[model samples]
Target chain A: MEGNLNALTVVFTEFYYWITVVVMFLIHVGFCMYEVGVSRRRNHMHTLMKNTMVIPLVTVTFYLFGWWIYFGFQGGPGITGGIGDAPFAEPWSALMATHLSGPSPDLGVSGDEAALWSRLNGVFWAAFLLFSWTTASIVSGAVIERIRSGAFWMLAVVIGSFAWIIDAAWGWSSQGWMVKLLGYHDAYASGVVHGIAGGFALGVLIVLGPRLGKFRADGTPRDIPPHNRWLVTIGLFLIYTGFWGFYAACNIPIISPEGIAGQITGETWTATNIYLAPTTLSAITFNFIMSLSGGMMAAYVVSKGDAFWTYSGGLAGIISASAGNDLYHPIQALIIAAVVVVVIYKLHYWVERRFKIDDAVGAVAVHGYAGSLGVIIAGFMLWGQPSSPYEGFATINPLGNFLGAVIMFGLLGFLPGYICARILNAFGILRIPRKVELEGLDFEGDETYNASVAEVIAAEKAMV
Target chain B: MSTNGLTSWAVDLKDVGAIYPFQGTETVLVIILLVFWIGWHVLQTRAETREFEHDLAADKSGDEQRKAIDRY
Candidate 1:
């Protein structure tokens, strides 16, 4: 508020994130369209609504506690330290709303708190809120056609507002214990977002079981093609578009060494990843395009030019390289992305055939399997590198990253999801009844649509 | 008479802490919003149950089922 350059930088950073939030909205639009495209004609509306409702439910819940958890649990509340303070994020905090940087004792904050909260709080909270939506939406696709919206909404709140945010606190936060002690690094959340969501979907699917008739008498799986191929491809394309915003949002757009107060020197201002480690958006852009190309090409050959796998491969490709994309060479990113997609593609079928676990959209393979691989692969690729610009944190290594992946995909992602889903199943609210599913989850709504169509047709014939 | 402390805009803008009316009522507003949010879920869940029940009965004729399958 005092000086020109300082004020401009703060305002610029706020506006930068605001734009990213708008762009990231497309990711949800894509998820909604993707689920609708994958569902059969009968189940279309139900599938779309089931995913759509996650928005408001998760937003409200995330506002209630999710933003607080990101700052509060950074310490593991014991491991690295105790619960950290985040007064600005509190629901009742005046800083949560419009305010100038000038002091406000009514809100019970010192001038320092006012300065940070006035500019960054709303946009930062909004940016993270979009990520919460993405995490829950990832689970939405795998459980389509049969999951009760009531049950799914609860699951969305758990993943979007609670479980995933805790993991972000643990791994993605700058002062997080995982980063402090273990050197757990996931720059773009390859494991944190995609891995956890994919695993959560897998856990729910295990208890929810397959859509009826997914497996035959011999226990072989059947292919359920998407009702509309074009929509699925377009959905994936929109996700890729929004992913640009996600990447930019993950960075502190521009910060000086003095601002970060870390090991970085020379007063250089640069874009830093979630851990406040220096990285250029340019470096990640090269890796993003390279990995995506590698995934599409590899998916084409492996799935033999299947449109669905090809598009999903593009997504899996970027996700597989995302962990190291901030630091990786373009060629290195490409190879890693291509290799992970091939392995995940093969594993998807192997799991389906061996376990008879029906993942409707291969979300488990594309997200969970590929994302974990990306995290572990980054360990080898970025070995001996600083996980943060901070002092005394462990250097990036295989063991820490491997454990981080396991914690993300299995421990945090799968375990709670499985337990909660099992409870919901025991109460028999998780999945629709067999008869209702077969007749179609959207049967009544579609019935009304068809009735209206028939009435209109009869009236038109009489006029003619 | 205003819920907000300020009765006029003649005061310096910088002195203003919260512009909205009833600034001190934040906790009350939050409580109300929370009640509305949770109440909405309860009501929606009930409507969902009723809608599912109706759909469950609608397909008893089997004719609609055949038509849907044929359309597929």
Candidate 2:
């Protein structure tokens, strides 16, 4: 607390991240509402609880090791020289707890690193923790109804605290191997968060199989309409609102030239993306609204004004433009969003019918397909552009981004999901038993309810 | 030349303005987007008409409609 300006900036940055974490919490709330709304009445309670529990399960596990993965693996062990150190992020590290802005003898963190992290660590950890919950929640929606709570929670920890964080370290970090060698860029985590989650959901879908009567005997898919269209629409709206905070959280808030230590030379301070490249809040705001409008309009036409698709399309639109939202023109964002929505909608059905995959919500298409497409499209859209302000990094290219998309969706996302699901299935814990699923996961609880109601009604009659 | 006219970000932040790709093609892009916007409505109206016609022809006995209403 030496200089007034320095103290103000540090406190303001902390408050800024704290507010974003609160707003981003609505993303999980929206996911719960949307999932339960899409599920049948018999499955509502189970669906809600299943998504809700991802919060505590992921939060604890993320605190234990997930935060460590982000800082420790940014080097790829070979790309940025060797295995990086992150003692401050460790669970038992003294720096992980509350401390005044001074170097501690209890932790191995250097004086310089400790001074910077002392104020920023908790809020930064919280912001990333919110992202962890979002990634896991994305998978929770696609596999509702038949999945066991135990199995789903295990999967949540894997994706929430492990898979997505590893991908973030690889692609989203400024000094990531993908950034250094491949020029991989996902400014708003289209591929890092949405793409990977979507891919993991698809991988599980392949092994878990469809919910009992998802397809007819002749190989045609059946439409299982949402129980509450209003809830689903409102949920999507809330998600869109929460996404504003998500966008802001992805930036550094404010940084001077000396802070960045990159090639951006000036006394002028500005907001930078994850890679320390310059951007502005005003630019992203324009693109966000424009892309969302483009998505909604295209979805209204394609789905013939279906409320669910219209809302989901707005999400898809933001996701499609998110890769380049940091730099895209509003109209460019609009057209890209429109084109991507059509592709994703078509792919959703094509994959559904071809594979008999029953995604309770259109998560695979909306998040997975849209996200992957966004990354690849950005490569072409932003080709020959610098992925980082740092020297010696490869320039952004179509081939690099295409490969990066595969690595995000298939390598990190799908592979781990399939392996974990297969192991769980072999142990007979991946899905509920056939009888329980057919009767509804809430069958026992519902029976207890009926019995209690009968006894209460009889007692009231006797009193009368 | 890069899409945004800067292949590298190794420059002063104060000098940068618009960083989006293809800075001068805004008019052409808008025209194309307008066509897409208009075309969607035409296709949507046709699809809605066909769906309603199918619904009208199939279960006019009100059994399915009643079930749908009750379920909601």
Candidate 3:
């Protein structure tokens, strides 16, 4: 009901986020396809279902508590402040539902707050929820065959609804403690989503162990080619498309200096990263494409033109440069991505051989290692840049970003993931039984379908 | 009265807010949803355990397993 400018801004912002949410859904679709494609034919249904179910499971739990965690724990809940306020994010908040800007008795907010949140909250929550699903799905691929579906779902909830959101709160949010104190600056969620999920998957893989026959008599890891390579190819392509949406979602889209209310001066409107520092859609697009190209080229050479690693390398490359993509020159992004891909590709095999981590889909290397390195790289590249528009906050630095990466990959990502998996493992529910793993995860379904086919065939033959 | 306190659309849109029904019962609904979610996990885990048990008890002949492997 305000002037046209305010109306257009609010509506445009709302619609912008809504479109991102729609596009981001392809990430899960891609995840489901990729996980299924990589798994053996015997494990197809189980792998697909395991990844597919993350959507509903994470969606509901994110609604229940994950959204609250993002808004409520931005201060680290203790480091710089106590649990911060985010009443609108609470599951029980009236603002969480359909509203049209006017205040109600049950709104628990002023008219202005209600107006702002009524249009924006659901879409914002949904965008974050997609990130949450991506986090869980990253883990889903790494531990496909042997992870008990129930146990994995529980772990998914832990990481998707709890662990990653907390990392996002401390590092990804504009006023997060990490930004304020550690000078953390991930323009996109190179670490907040990918790093945490990758580390989380690593922790789970450590306990779950590799699928049966994933290792040989000499203890060297087996190649385990995908049952269907086409699925993997298309899946990665879809993920790349969805990533465009993910990048857009990370920005504020449009905001004026007054809207940001920070050191950013002049009447010019601009898009901002999650930290509320200025960037542009054009800048990210340039960096995204260049870094992706760099990663694919490096990976093709490093992995000797392996289709799987090449695609994954492209993803890792984008993730590697994503931390500073907002401000990075396209060439810098490409070089960083290329360099990071080579390191991560070598490290992937090194860890697989030395530690015997059987990452079925190379998720740990692509997301976790690359994301952690990306953050640290950004600190050096964007050295001394303001982490926020707000006065008196820490500026981006190597040490701060390195610590932020550790916090993302180790403290928030790996720790919670390991602890949850350990608890589930202790209960004798983490891994499927040896016999079941050998028999294939889809034994029951396969048996039923086989019997149905046989019976129908016999009946038709008799009729003939 | 309507649950969201809107009896008609005759009023100004700017003066309206939450349009969902049972507005004040959000807390109660949330508690129920949480219970349902947790309960689903419990039921699912138990069922999965039973399924594994059934599979284990059915056969160790290795013939079917071999066929399944051959199918792969």
Which candidate achieves the best TM-score against the true structure?
A: 2
Candidate lDDT (C-alpha), each: 0.86, 0.90, 0.86
Task: Determine the backbone clash count of candidate 1.
Answer: 0
Candidate 1 ranges with C-alpha deviation above 4 Å: A457-464, B1-72
The positional error of residue B71 in candidate 1, measured at the CA in angstroms, is 17
Residue-level lDDT tens digits of model 2 in A1-464: 55777777778888989999999988988998999899998888899999999999999999999999998888876767576788889998777888775744656766656766788889999999999999999999999999999999999999999999988999998899998899998999889999999999999999999998899999899998999999999899989988998998998888888878888777889888888888888888898899999999988888878999999999999999899899899999998898899899999999999999998899999999999999999999999999998989988889989998999999989999999999999999999988988888888888999899999999999999
In angstroms, how far off is A407's CA in candidate 2? 0.4
Tell me the deviation in Å of residue A3 in model 1: 1.4
Q: Per-residue lDDT of A255-313 in model 1, one digit per residue for the tens?
A: 87777878665655778799987778888888799889878877866775688998899
Native contact fraction per model:
0.00, 0.86, 0.00
Angstrom error at residue A40, model 1: 0.3
Clashing pairs in 2: none
Minimal lDDT window, size 10, model 1 chain B: B6-15
Cα-based lDDT at residue A449, candidate 3: 89
Q: Give lDDT: candidate 1, residue B57.
A: 84
